[model samples]
Each structure stands twice: as C-alpha cells, then as structure tokens.
Target: MNPNPVVAIAGATGAVGVEMIRCLEERNFPVKELKLLASARSAGKTMKFRGKDIVVEELTEASFKGVDIAFFSAGGGISRKFAQAVKEAGAVMIDNSSAYRMDPNVPLVIPEINPEAALHHNGIIANPNCSTIIAITPLWPIHKVNRVKRLVAATYQAASGAGAAAMEELEQATRAFLSGEPFEQKIIPHPYPFNVFSHNSNVDPETGYNEEELKMVKETKKIFGDDNIRVTATCVRVPVLRAHSEALDFECENPITPKEVRDILAKAPGVKIVDDVSANYFPMPKDASGKDDILVGRIRQDISDPSGRSIAMFVAGDQLLKGAALNAVQIGELLVR
Candidate 1:
C-alpha cells in the first residue's frame, strides 16, 4: 500500500455517510485522494476534505477504480447492487449494510472485539448491526474472560439509527405536540415523539421478532465464534436522536461480580466504564453521542440468580460513529497496514 492510500466514500451525504467522512478525518487517515460518491441526486454537491472541496460523484462501476478502500453506508440495495463491482474495481469495501454480514466469507467486525478478523476480508467486510456491535464491545472482552452461556438482551435504539430523516421526524413530531398542531409521520411506521415502538420491521412470519432482533441474536454468536450460545432479544426504537442503548441479562459460565466486570471493561480497548451506583453516574444517550468509546453503566448483580454467575448492565454507544462510521474507518485503517 502507498504511504497515502486513495479512499472512496459511497453515500457520502447521508447521515452515517457524513459521519464516515468526519471519522476518517478525525483519525487522520492517510488520504492521498478522497472520493465522495453518492446517487445522482447528491452528485455535484461538494464536501470539504483535506482543505479542498471535493465534488460528490454519481456512483457507477468506475467509481471504485484506482480506489484503495471504499467505505459504504448507502443502503442494502445499493450494496447488493454495486459492492461486488467496487471489489472488482480493485478496492476493498467496508460495507455498513446488512447485505453481506451473514456471508461466511465476510467478516462482521467491531474492531474492539475482533480486530484480528479484519485481516480475513474477501474484498468486502461487513459491519455488524449497530445494537449488536455496542453490546459486544463491552461484553466480548468479558465473554473471553468468562464464557457467555445463555443471553437475553433488549435494545433501546435511537432515531439516528434509521438515518437523518427519522431524526427530523422525531423533532417535528415533538415540536408539533408542544404547539398543539397535528403530528405528521412518514419516515417511520409510528409517530416519533416521546414514544417507543418495536424496532422489528416487516415481521418474520415464523419467529415474530423483527429482522433487526434476529440479526442481533445470530450476529452475536457468529462474531463470538459460538454457535452454541443461546440468545434471544427484543429490539425497540426510542425517541432519542443519537446513542443506542442495550440492557443485557447474560449468564456466564463462571461466577462474575460487578467489580470484576468493571475491572475487565476498564482495560478493554474502545470501552469506557461509568458504573457508579451511589451518585447515579451511568451511561446515557446524551453522554455517549459523538464519542468513539462504548459506555457501560448500571452495573449490578441480577438477584434470584446464583451469585458470581450472572450480571445485568446497560451499554450505550454512538450508532453513527462506533456503530457505523468509525467501525468502517477502523477496518480501512487495519486493511492498509
């Protein structure tokens, strides 16, 4: 690889797309040439990178030519359509869509838990679902120490996970509620202000859980290299704009305590512990947003269960950064070296 490798950012104007750009710059990724590609609607718009205003180009087969790495956040449809083409263009793709996540050949990486897996990319590596990535960031380190057995989790995801339009819808609905005006809804199936809805979209006729929930259960086991780890989940969409939170009730193979969990997480890379029960210092959406580290708090032992064998905690991370943008950038960083 060259000292400054060329990189392309597909869907460079969307919510996660914009965050990808910032993350690459923040991390000081060596960018000899930065190409921002989007759909025809977004082409011709300009984005500044490395002190120059780079024009957003319409994505085509040629978009990835001469590109060293491509960070994709467009959508599953776009990824399914052009991901292979990007690879054929001789660039490695770090895709943020679910299209290739379950592919046996593609590595669904969190960087914190499985940096080694990033080396096995077959041109396109998948970023795990946002909720699963954050939960595993704190849990994987512990799982390595005390093997996770049966797991149950519920996610409190934010509107930003759905993209910028959903965030705007939440804001509009909240303002409309306060002003005694009619609430409008379109981006999401349900109204967004001060409300919660099942995050599952288009129910799976057999399981009843939404595709997102199913992804969490399956991806967790796959990423951890444990098909035998029993898991179940309930994913819910919350009105928050940025961070995605998860409440995990996991029973491990060994007895685990709050202090031991804190000790392990405090030293894990990309994990920030905030578990102080006396002052009620815990991780929150506002506190986690715009940050790179996953925050874990509300640490306590789950009673009615065997001591040192079970623990319950809350984890939060920026869905746009570590969840999507930062993860993809880190993949590129690892790929270059």
Candidate 2:
C-alpha cells in the first residue's frame, strides 16, 4: 500500500458508496487521489470530496489501474467481475458485499475485533454483514472475557440496508400512507410503510432461514474463528430510513452479569455505551443514525437460563458506515499501517 494511496470507490453513487467517500474525508485518510466508479447510468455525475467535485466514472476492468486501494460496495456480481482486475492491478480490494465473505482465501474483518486477520488477506478482504457487525461489535469484548457459547439475535433492519432507493421508498410510502393515497412498493418487497416483515432476502425452505440470517450466523463464526459458537437469527425489515437495530441474547461459557458486560463494552473499541435504566433510555435507531460507534444498551440477564450464564442487550449502528463503508475503509487503513 502506498503511504498516500489512490483510493477508488466502486458503486460510488449508492448509499454505502457515498458513505465510503465521507468516511475517507472524515477520517482524513491519506488519499493521493480519489476515483468514484459507478454504473453507466450514474457515470458523468459529480460527487463532492474535500471541497472538490469528482466526476463519477463508469466502472470497468481498467478502473483499477493505478489504484492502490479499492473499496467495493457494488453488488456481489460486480465485485466478482472486477476482483481479478483489482488484484492484478496490484491494489488491495476491501469488499463490502457478501461476494467473498466466507471464502477461506478472503479474511472476514471487523477492525475492532480481528484486525490481525485482515493482514493475511489474499489481496481481498470481506466486510461482515450489517446485522452481524452491529451485534458482534459489542459481543466480541464480552466473548473475550467469558466465551460466548450461543447467540440468538433478532434484527430490526432499516430500509437503507436494501439501498438508497429502498430508503426513499420508505419515506415516500410513509407519506402516501399518511395521506391515504395508494402507493406502489418497488424497491422493497413488502409494503414497508408502518409495517414490519421478514428480511427481504430469500428464505431457505429446508432450514427456514433467510439469507440475511444465515449471513449473520456464518459470518459471526468466521470472524470470531469459532465454529462451535451456536448462532441463530430472525431478521426483519423495519420502517426506519437509516441505522440497524438488534436485540441480542447470548449464553456464555461462564457466568456473566450486566455490570460486567457494561464494563467490558465501555472499554471496547468502536462501541458506545448507551444503557440508561432510570431514564429508560437505550440504543435506538434515531440516536445511532450517522454515528460511527455502535450504540449498545438494555443490558440484563436472560432469566430463561437456569445457570445464569445468559445475557441480553440491544444495539444500533449505521448500516452504511461501520456495517459497510467504514469497515472496508478501516481495513484499508490497516493495510496502510
């Protein structure tokens, strides 16, 4: 990696791609140059970075030329198509999609957790799923202190997880619902206004688990390097426009308490403790929107476990930031360092 790298963002006009540009600027990443690559339809558009307008270019195999680091936020197919080009260009690819997450050759990375794993990447690193990142950020610290044996997560995912269009659909649908006007749902599968449904990802008939839930389950084990960790999830799409929230319950190998969990998370990186009992405030999507840190709260014991080894908590994080772009950028930073 160059000391000051020429960074390229594939799918630069999308929600996560836009955030990737902002993260680089906000974090003051040493960028010798910036390249914004998107689809042909988005090409010729201008986006701002460092008070300058950079025109978005159509992504091609040749887009990786002279690019030291490439942040890929496009869909899996795009990432797969251009991956070889990126590697052959002598640039590192930090991918946000699930294209190569479970690949043994690609390291699944969360900077706050297994950063060292990123160093072993084979020219590509994979960011974990948004819900997995939100849940596991706080859980990693606790797992370090008392090994987590099992995890059960129920994710309240925002429309933003689908993309910028889905977010706009959410807002537009809400207005249409309030005005008693007919609205057609295009981006999101279900009627998103004032309603909740299972995650938009296709469900597996045999296992009864959606792709989103399966990603959380598999990615958590890979990132933690603990296949023995039992994981299950029920993912749902909520009406929020941004930020994802999760209700997490986990059983540890040893006994753990709320105070211990709080203390552990308070000192953990990329985590913000928001557990307030008297005021009855906990992590919320509204509060977590646009935040870099994952807000965690509602810590308590899961009484269902007779052994008193289970704990429950709530967490929220910006899906486009830490869950996607920021995490990919953080991996790039690790490479540079």
Candidate 3:
C-alpha cells in the first residue's frame, strides 16, 4: 500500500457515502487524493474533505483507475457491476454493501472482531450489515471468553438503515401526522409516523425471516468462524432517524453474570459502557448518533434460564458511522498498516 493512498468514495452523495468521507478525514487516514463518484444525477455536486472541495463524478468503468482504495456504498447492483473493475485497477475495494459479504472469497469484516480477516482479502473486503455490526461489536468479546452456544437478537433499526431519503420521509410523516393530515408513504412501504413494523426487506416464506435478520445470523457465524453458534434474529424498523439499537440474549458454554459481562465489554475495543441503574440511563439512539463507539448497557442475566449460563444486553450505535463507513475505513486502515 502507498504511504498516502488515493481513495475513492462510491455513492458519495448518499448517507453512508457522505459519512465514509467524514470518517476518512476524522481518522486522518493518509490520503494523497480523494475521488467522489456517484450516479449521473448526483454527479457534478461538490463535497468537502480535508478543507478542499472535491467535485463528484459519475461512476464509470474508468473511475477506479489509479485509485489505491475504493469504498463502495452505492448498493448491491453497483458493487456487483464494479467490484471486479476495482480489483483490476490495483485498488483494494472495501465494500459497504451486502453484495460481497457472504461470498466465500470475500472477507466480511468488523475491524474489532476480524481484523485478521482483512489481511486475507482477495482484493475486495466486505463490511457487514449495519445491525450486525451494532450487535456483534460487544458480543465478540464475550463469545471469545465464554464460547457463545446460542445467540438470539432483536434489532430496533432506524430509518438511516434504509437511506437518507427514508430519514427525511420519517420526519415529514411525523409532521403530517401531528397536523392531522395523511402522509403518503414513499421511501418506506408502510406509514412511518409513530409506527413500528417488521423489517421491510423481502421475507422468506419457508423460515419467516427477513433478509436483514438472516444477515445478522449468517454474518455473525461467519465472522466468528463458528457455524455452531446457533444464531437467530428478528429485525424491526422503528421511527428513529439515525442510530440503531438491539437486544441480545446469548447462552454461553460457561456460566456468566451481568457484572462479569459488563467488565468484559468495558475492556473490549470500539465499545463504550453506558449502564447506570439508579439514574435509569442506558444506550439510546439519541445519545448514540454521531458517536464512533457502540454504546452498550442493560446487562442482566436471562431470567428464563435457571442454569445461569445466559446473559442479555442492549446496545446502540450510529448506523452510518461505526456500522457502515467507519468500519469500512477501518478495514482500509488495516490494509495501509
């Protein structure tokens, strides 16, 4: 890798893409130049990085030439079409889309959990799903110590997971609802104001699990290298505009306590403890938005399990930062090191 690599941000106008640019600047990653690429409609716009304005260009087959690292967040279709071109251009493509995550050749990574995996990437490394990153950042430390036997997770996902337009739609819908006017649903399938629904992803009729839920299950096992972990998840979309929260219940091979679990997470990387019982404070989306660390709290023993081997907890993290852009940038940093 070049000491100061040239970086490109695909989908530079979208929510995660914008954050990808911010993260690179915030982290002070050594960059000789920055390229912004988006769709034709988004092209010609300008975004600032390192105090300089860079014009966005329409992504084309020639875009990746001479780029040392490319961060992709456009969507799966764009990734599928352009990933090989990125590799052929002699750049490492750290994809933030679901396009290549499950590919056997690609390393689906959360830097805190699988930094070693990034080293083995065959030119393209995949960033895991946003909800999966929020859930597993804390879980991996515990699983390493206790050997998680089974994990059941329920996610409270935000509109940010869908995109910037969905967030705007949520805000618009709320105002319309309060004014006693019907809001037309556009970005999200159902009514958004003060309503919660199962994840809007296409569902599998055989197992009754949405794509997001299954991504959590499969990606967790793959990242941990333990297919026997027995992971299950339920993903729901909430009215929140930014961060995502998840409730996780894990049955470990050895008995564990809430205090012990808390202790483990405090020492873990990319985690911040926010548990305070007396004041009734824990991880919340409002607090987690714009933060780099995943805020974790609400640690307790799973009461249903008399065996004392089960622990439950809650976590909140910025879906756009740590969940998507930051993680991808972290992978790029790994390549540089």
Candidate 4:
C-alpha cells in the first residue's frame, strides 16, 4: 500500500457516501488523491475534500484503475456489478452494503469487533448492516471477556438507513401530516410521519423474519466466528431521522452484574456510557447523531432470567457514521496501516 493512498468514493452523492467524505476528512486519513464516483445523473457535480473541489464522475469499469481504496456505499446492485472491476483494478474495496457480506471468501468486519478478519480479505471487505453494527459493537467487548451464549436484539432503526431520500420523505410527510394534508410515500413501504412499522426489507414467509433481521443474525455469527452462538433479532423502522437504537439481552454462561457490564463497556473502544439513573438519562438518538462512538447505557440484569446470567442494555449509534461510513473508513485505515 502507498504511504498516502488514492481513495475513491463509489456513491459520492448519497447519504452514506457524503458521510464517507466527511469521515475521511475528520479522521485525517492520508490521501494522495481523491476520486468521487456517482451515477451518471450525479456526474458533473463537485464535492469538496481537503479544501479542494473534486468532480463526481460516472461510475464505470475504469473508475477504480488508480484508486488504492474504493469505499462503496452505493446500493448492493452497484457493488455487485462493479466489485470485480474494483478488485481487477487492484484496489481494496471496503463495501458498506449487503452485497458480499455473506460470501464465504469475503470478510464482514467491524473494526472494534473483528479487525483481524480484515487481514484475510481477498480484495474486498464487507461492512455489516447498520443495525447489526450498532448492536454488535458493544456486545463484542462483553463477549470477549465472558462468553455470550445467546443474543436477542430488537432494533429501532432510523430512516437514514434507507437513504437520504427516505429521510427527506419523512420530513415532507411529517409537514404534510401536520397540516392535515394527505401524504404520499416514495422510499418506504408504509406511512412515514409519526408512524412506525416492521423493517421494509423482504421477509421470509417461513421464518417471518425480514432481511434486516436476518442480516443481524447471520452477520453476527460470521463476525464473531461463532456459529453456535444463538442470535435473534426483530428490526423495526422508527420515526427517527438519523441514529438507530437497539435493546439487547445477552444470555451468558456465568452470572454477571450490571456494574461489571457497565465497567467493561466504559473502557471499551468506540463506546460511550450514557447511563445516568439519577436523571433518567440514557442513550438517545438525538445525542448519538453524527457521533463516532456507539452510546451504550441502561445496563441491568435481566429480571426475567433467574439464572443471573442474563444482562440487558440499550444502545444508540449513528447509522450513517459509525454504522456505515466511519466503519468502512476505519477498515480502509486498517488496510493502509
């Protein structure tokens, strides 16, 4: 790898794509040159990086020719179509979509949880699902110390996970509803403003689990390298615009207390403890938005479990930042390290 690598952003105009640019700037990743690639329609647009205007180009077979690292936040379709081109160009593709995450050869990595997995990437590295990243980042520390036998996560995802248009639609729909006007939805399946629904991803009729939920289950196992570690998730789309929140219950092998769990997470990288029982304060989407760290709090022993081995906690993280863009950038940083 070059001491200062040439970086490319595949979906430079989209939500996560824009955040990727910001992360590179914020993290001060060494870059010899920057290329911004988007759809043809988004071509000719210019995005700024390191105080210079870089024109967005149409993504093509030749886009990755000189890019040392290609950060792909475009949809899976684009990644599927161009990933090989990226690899053929000899650029390390850090993808932030579901395209190659489950591929046997590809490594699904969250730097905090599985940085070593990235060392084995065969040209492409997959970033886990946004909800999965937010949920699992905090789990890794505890699971590293005390074995986690099972995981139960219920995510209250935000509109940002869908894309920037969905976030705008939510705002538009909210204003229309406030004025007593009928609102039409575009990005999401159901009504957006002041409403919540199951995740919009296709559901498996047999298991009654949505694609988002299934990703959490499968990706967790793959990242943890523990096929036997039981995992289940119920993912829902909430009215929030940015960060995603999850309630996780961990079933461990031995008894653990709330203080022990809290102490573990307090020192864990990429985590922020927000539990303030005196003021009833805890992790909130408003506080987590635009932040790099995943906020974890509301730690307590599971009241329903008599074995004293179960712990419950609430976590919030910016799905676009730490969940997608920052995580991919972190992987890119690791690649050059």
lDDT of 1 by residue, 152-246 (tens): 89999999888998888889999998898998688988877878999937779898888998888899988898998888889999999989999
How displaced is residue 88 in candidate 1, in Å?
1.6
| TM-score of every prediction relative to native | 0.97, 0.99, 0.99, 0.99
Instruction: Please list the C-alpha lDDT of all candidates, in the order they appear.
Output: 0.88, 0.93, 0.94, 0.93
For model 3, the stretches where C-alpha displacement exceeds 4 angstroms are none
Q: What's the TM for model 3?
A: 0.99
Give candidate 3's error at residue 184 in angstroms: 1.1
Report the Cα lDDT for residue 70, model 3.
93
lDDT of 4 by residue, 166-218 (tens): 99999999999999999889889899888899999999999999999999999
lDDT of each residue in 1-337, candidate 3, tens digit only: 8879999999999999999999999999999999999999999999999999999999998999999999999999999999889989999899999999999999999889989999998899999999999998899999999999898999899999999999999999999999999889889998889989999999999999999999998998899999898989989999999999999899999899998898899899999999999999999999999999999998999999999999988999999999999999999999998
**Model 1 Cα shift for residue 335 (angstroms):** 0.6
Candidate 2 local lDDT, 1-337, one digit each (tens): 6889999999999999999999999999999999999999999999999999999999999999999999999999999999999999999999998999999999999999999999998899998999999999899999998999999999999988999999999999999999999999988878988899999899999999999999999999999999999999999999998899999999999999888998898899999999889999999999999999999999999989889899998999999888888888899899888
**Candidate 4 lDDT for residue 307:** 95
Instruction: Please give the lDDT score for candidate 2.
Output: 0.93
lDDT of 4 at 192: 80
